[model samples]
Target: MPQLSVIVYGPNTQGHLTELLDSLDAHPLADAEVIVAAVGDWARETAGSHSPETIVVPLPDGTGDAAARAAGAARASGRWLHFVHAKDGLPAGAPRLIVERTAELDAMDTPGALAGPGAPDAPGAPVDVLLFDHVSTTWQTTAAPSGDGRLLAAVGRAGLPLDRSASLLRTAPLLGNRALRAAFWRAHEEEFTTDDEPYAACAALLRAGRVACLNQVAHEKRVLRPESLPPLAPEDRLALIDRYESLLALTEDRRAARTVLYDLMVRDLVRTFARENLPDPVAREFFHRASLAAVRWRPEGHQRPAGLEGVRHSLLEEGAYTRYRAFQAANRTRRAARKALRSRKRQVSVKVRDHQYRRALSRPVDPHLAVFTAYWDRGVACNPAAIAAKLAELAPHIRRVWVVSKENAALLPPGTDHVIPGTRRYWETLAGAKYLTNNVNFPGAVVKRPDTIHLQTHHGTPLKRMGLDQMDHPAAAQGLDFAALLARIDRWDYSVSANSHSTRMWERAYPARYTSLDHGYPRNDVFYTATAADVRAARARLGIAPGRTAVLYAPTHRDYEAGFTPRLDLAALADRLGENTVLLVRAHYFYGGAASPLTGLRRSGRIIDVSSYDPVEELCLAADALVTDYSSIMFDYANLDRPIVVYADDWETYRTTRGVYFDLMAEHPGKVAHSQEELTEIFLTGAWRDESAAKARAAFRRRFCEYDDGRAAERVVRRVFLGEPEEALPPVLPPEERTPAPTPEEATA
Candidate 1:
């Protein structure tokens, strides 16, 4: 039989399993075998890439990992077994190290080393199983118990935890006892898996003082597995009770063991209860009773994890849980009632405005123009500002009206005639305007005129599904009527696209007869023309410190979630990046209606809320790096030739619920981080750019920024307003004519 068998769980779609296999192959252990338990046939593809002797077990779809682990253990043909979670791999030296330790544990020379698992009670039989870790370093573990008669009691009294490491164990104990195999399945069936098996198998062996420590690290672990805590199910609760009962019967000191188990189980339950948001009253009551039980029967005083001080206090407090639940129910009811009332009001308002929306068109359509970005009710600036500026300069004779929100009436530039939305003047302008332009869809209420040309300057190059393509998205398409939406899109006389990919996406998705300029985003046109003085001026406006790397952390809004959910912990991020990094945060216009994300922080020098910063182009010019998730702004930022890191912690959820056009994990313009730790590491080590994301950035530029010459605005003006043919546009100026970016020295100065 092979000396080592490695079992891997989860599909290897990310090729994490392949990495483990490569590591094992590089650090060869003679007769070592690999067993992969995966849900799909794709495992076979990964298995094929592994060593010749590797085995692939087709796990039942949706089978719990515990069951999959048991199945892999049964198929293993090794004296010692090593379990691997998918995201974590054995270090290159781990295979050789574990091999050496397992041999040492079985050696006859070692004091109290295992003499195999045969009748462990026999004189000189192995007294303890050796525990080790994957890395060279090991945690505090038991030394060999040589002839220690009270070793069983000592093992329990020591209160050592069997961490979820790639631990080595004798196959004889697992193989010889058919009851142990049954117990493994039984424990998993009872929702008592990792805890139950390790405890049961190790306890039985430790009775004969068979638990030993190699005083070395054996295997690595990562945030690869889903939470193994019991769900809000009756079976899960019973499973916990069953395991507790089983352990109570076996422990040498039931009181002490129960105390320890209760504390640990309560900590796990508290977290699960809060995070799982259990809706079942029966299960919730059961958990409440369990907490009471812990308080009533706990051997020692109670213990709780941090952040659960309130939970612990509530359990000890009289009638607190009841009152809290009642208050939550009442609040939920209040919210529902308010939502219904608001929905009714909206319906009434829509009905009342139906005639007037069309009546506004009765006025003569102004032959000149009006432009708004995003929405009529919105106060923001983006591509529209650049387009508005170019239009003023190129065709000043054409009457221009800036459509801004009432709240933002003061923001209109000096000498620029602006009309507040919803006013009578706004309606007259809407009726009169021969030209209308916006970066997003026009207000649904606005009626399209026959001769008026509406240009849709869509924001961003899409990575996620949008427009008609997102009709299938549950979250993205909630309350959305595709027919009406496409009708509005059809009204567009011209649609501005940032790139060829975007042009194709727009043409396929909209399919309306509209001229697509594909002239690149006007917002990024400055990147091509901005001189060093321009870059310096933008940096000065933003108040960036010398030698500081401005990392703009901009994440896209989730359509499914409500309000501005702060994904990045600002304080933690600031601390992680250190003082030299200034975090320039720009929120989406949807989140809190342009409110800065950094509201309540101590106003530390580290974080800057640049949401109100005029023209994001300046922020891009000033910043050294960008960190974003699922935001198409990455495509825009790539043109700046800066480093970008994708911190897509919820990539799976975002991809499935909202959907994406590409597998960003594989082909994002930057390294896509799955966790804050990895993201921080990348930023701190400067791996977020240059070394990690350079090649992808180049490719991204070619794909998304082909037509983003500084003269995009000029092209839009010449073609749309000046009535010039595409070929009749003036030649793009040489690079020297466009302002050069300030040197690093000048920027710092």
Candidate 2:
């Protein structure tokens, strides 16, 4: 008999299986037998040749992997059987981990704690079953570490389904018991979730013998096609309901029973399987029945929002026949209103564009024009704000009208003629303006006439990938339309670059033939000119306590997650830092949330969320230290010459997924904290301010800080806005020439 039998299932996964078999071949699996449980002859042919013994089983048409798993297991000759999805690859450590964990289970009197009572285990007894975890991999973040794998939760009804991630079982224990095999075969035939195999395996293992699991990762579940789980058909939904209902009937405990029913009703019935899902009368009736069964079981737990009680009450008390037609009518009206809001705004824009266009025709081509930074409505910041201020000093004729977004209009500085974007005034000014300067591109719809001088002053330097490097990368170019992006870039008359790195990146990424102004970033000008008194004043303005050190905790975002996932517990961090520190929580610009602390701790003023504060430069001025992950903000913060603590908990995931230009943890200026505990320890121990870190910061500055000198704004205005030559801007001086020479004796020492 074979030592181990590997049964593989192949579906729409065409190119994935060959690599899986290749990996298995690379690793010596001499004692294993291979079985390709294929839908057709193609998957088996796709597998090519393999070692040990190989068998191909053609599954019945119109069936899922569950049926194939059952059929494959019946024919396997190996004592130990492992089931793998053709789309997933076995991790190198899986075979060894299976043995170690199996040995550990064999030595135990009972299986691991979750195995429960009546477990069949005598010391030295062979393992009946072993389930392992999967490392969830996505194309966006391909490099995440292996250990952060998760098994299906035991709480939700959906949790009962076995994850296609990985499964290993003892053939004899599974095949010996008729009832167990029947239970599995029935569950498999139901063909509900992908985890049906595990659900069935759990049923069989519970009856036949003790079940053991290695929560350790032994395979990769790559999410190459992000939308692989297609919408459930009405039959698919009914199948899921049947599976959950059966599981509910079997579950003896109230909590487990409630959980099973909750998943069926709450997860599907009222949520996904509403009247909208398969609007068929039969499907709707099943959803209602499931909802009624769930509410009768228990209305609470499952961490569902208490507010949803009204919804539950409506469904349970009011019959399914009750039509909330008013809801549909009202939603349609609201949707129409939302769609019309933009049309109404654009009508006003057209009127204003004409007015502004006509008004500018009478007026001379005033170099004094509109300036925007970042998005349309951002306040005076970045290159535009700096350039705008310098223009007023040099030529007072320059009329600077700021275009703001209505939502972010509050952040715009007062005493300026600011027009909300899409407003009549904004459209007029944009159309009429002689010179337009913005860090980001203007609307692609905006026709950049030959007379207009458009300056593209981008926001920051990059260590992570940017622009064209991310053209094909989903994670980097999330929500961006590349053709539209390039169209906007094509409108630019001058593209400002902070350094050679940015220049090269922007030039390649934005292939428009715009003139490149290789001057340093104007945003960093504040760092050079800000005195001690300025820092103190900025701190006072933001309400940082006099004695407390302002620590700016700004973390970079992950592409895979929807928004910011809070890695650090805010309350715990504050407690760790004590009363001597104040934390300014600066989330990435894309995220928004409630004013409450991330930990849901009752509102305390120790940690202030500065994510809304548009001017990060002001935060930098107020801060004594910077704490961040892989954000390019660290590179900017280094110019402040303050302490920097890099807290990169998901470094491996981020590096593997996002692909950074440099190893941040190894090269960062200050202490590199792998966890919140270490970051807190650094602050508590005051090791964030070591002399070595200071020296590292100096080196980092030498490498990245070649361009900035407070005169960057003047250089940009003089060249692009004022029509001066690039050489008119002062040349970037060498470090030795820029700084005062050290004393001869000190230098010699």
- TM-score of candidate 2 relative to the true fold: 0.57
**Candidate 2 weakest lDDT stretch, 10 residues:** 172-181
* Cα distance off (Å), candidate 2, residue 448: 2.4
Model 2 / residue 432 / CA error / Å: 2.2
**Model 2 Cα shift for residue 572 (angstroms):** 3.1
Error of 2 at 539 (Å): 1.7
Instruction: Provide the clashing-pair count of each candidate structure.
Output: 24, 13
lDDT tens readout by residue for model 2, 182-249: 22233333432345543454345432333444444455565576365565566655665555555445
Q: What are the Cα lDDT values of the candidates?
A: 0.62, 0.62
TM-score of each: 0.53, 0.57
Whose TM-score is greatest here?
Answer: 2
lDDT of 1 by residue, 1-749 (tens): 76666777666645566766766654445656778877566665776777776788887566665676667777877756666655555533444444544555456433533332232334454423444322211122111111221222233312122221112222212211111112222323333235344444434432323344333223444332334323445435535544444443443443444555555445545455445555577556656665555555455554444643554545533435666466556757998999999999989876656556567677676666665555444544667777777887988878767777777777766776777766667766777788888877776767777878888888788788887888888788878888888888888999888788889888887889999996777777788777778877787888887787788888888876543434565656677788888888887766545223244332456888776676777888888888999888788888776788998878999999897888888887877777666788887777776655888877777777777768888888888877899888755543224443444345557
lDDT of candidate 1 at residue 524, scale 0 to 100? 77
